[model samples]
Target: MIFEMTTQVRVSNIEEGHKWYETLINKHPDFIPHKGFVEWELIPGCWLQVAEGELTEGNGPLRLGVTDIEGERERLIKELTIERFEIHSRPEVPVKWGTFRDPWGNRIGFFEYLDKKEEETQIKSILGTDSSRV
Candidate 1:
């Protein structure tokens, strides 16, 4: 019966973390409730929060769905100066994925579906739009 969800990652400095995440996500946060916290509604009700606090480890390689994993990886490497991370996949796997740590050491990653049709279907379902029309 869960209607919405959120995942939080902590950073030592809110200002730097906010800018880093903004660059990675390519958008300003959808909400900033207080001085030390910010949130982005990544997809409808699902939220990703960045907070000012002590760092935590082994939290998540929070993999976001993307249309192009290679392109994203390259962009991140160039923009964030993150070490190149390898994308992995198997014959039975439906998507390719790669993980890299943020400047604060939070695990984050991207995934791209192997099937373009399935990718479009998910996009249409989430956005409630006809891909052919857009």
Candidate 2:
């Protein structure tokens, strides 16, 4: 059996969006940097592409469930000058997740399955429970 998924994100400037994905791939370990596309090969024969857009409301691949949410978020803020961006909601998902628009008005979400140990620690800290129980 074979399975594949492709998603698209709209952008105003393909060059800028390409650069953003390039930086992300360079900074993150999971991504395999490609000239025209940034790919993440989660497993053999399965990959995700982040590439250039061909239209005014450009459509590039969608990225979801990314493990390095905080790092990616910081990089986007530092590198790209987003015209306007907003966090639609907090990380209420089992996996820490949130959405934001890029400089070109492309909507993207960053997320990952929460680390069990990290989640336990976070819950304990919030409830003022003892570390020993975590």
Candidate 3:
């Protein structure tokens, strides 16, 4: 069975890319196995790697689930100086999402479930705790 996954993005400079991703994710990488490569375990089985290499152009708008999309947008703008991006949703859709680009032009985005209960359940599942109690 396909049980785990990893996604990679490339940048010309490892130091700058590492710092940028660390700030965006609000934590240092969980793994740095060698020079010029770093990774974060975004969830239990999913990993995101940033490596030193040619830019991976037009790769993705890798969306992360968030509790507050607008708040995250504001934080990214203030902290990373990213250009403001619009959040969108539809009546038929269960979540709202927004996209922006990192300094190296990697597409990144965040999403928030409209149903707060569902979002909480997901959070608990990923973290193995009731976030509200923590």
For each candidate, the alpha-carbon lDDT, in order, equals: 0.93, 0.54, 0.93
Model 2 clash number = 0
Candidate 1 on 23-69: residue-level lDDT in tens? 89989999999998999999888999999998998889898999999
- TM-score of each candidate structure, all chains considered together: 0.96, 0.50, 0.96
User: How do the residues 1-134 of candidate 2 rate in per-residue lDDT, one tens digit apiece?
Assistant: 55565444434455665567556455432453655455555333445455555533544324455545776677777776433333333456567666776566556666655776675565565446764653
How many clashing pairs in candidate 1? 0
- Displacement of the residue 31 alpha carbon in candidate 2, Å: 12
Q: Against the hidden true structure, what lDDT does model 1 obtain?
A: 0.93
lDDT of 3 by residue, 74-125 (tens): 9889999999999999999999999999989999999999999899888998
Clashes of each: 0, 0, 0
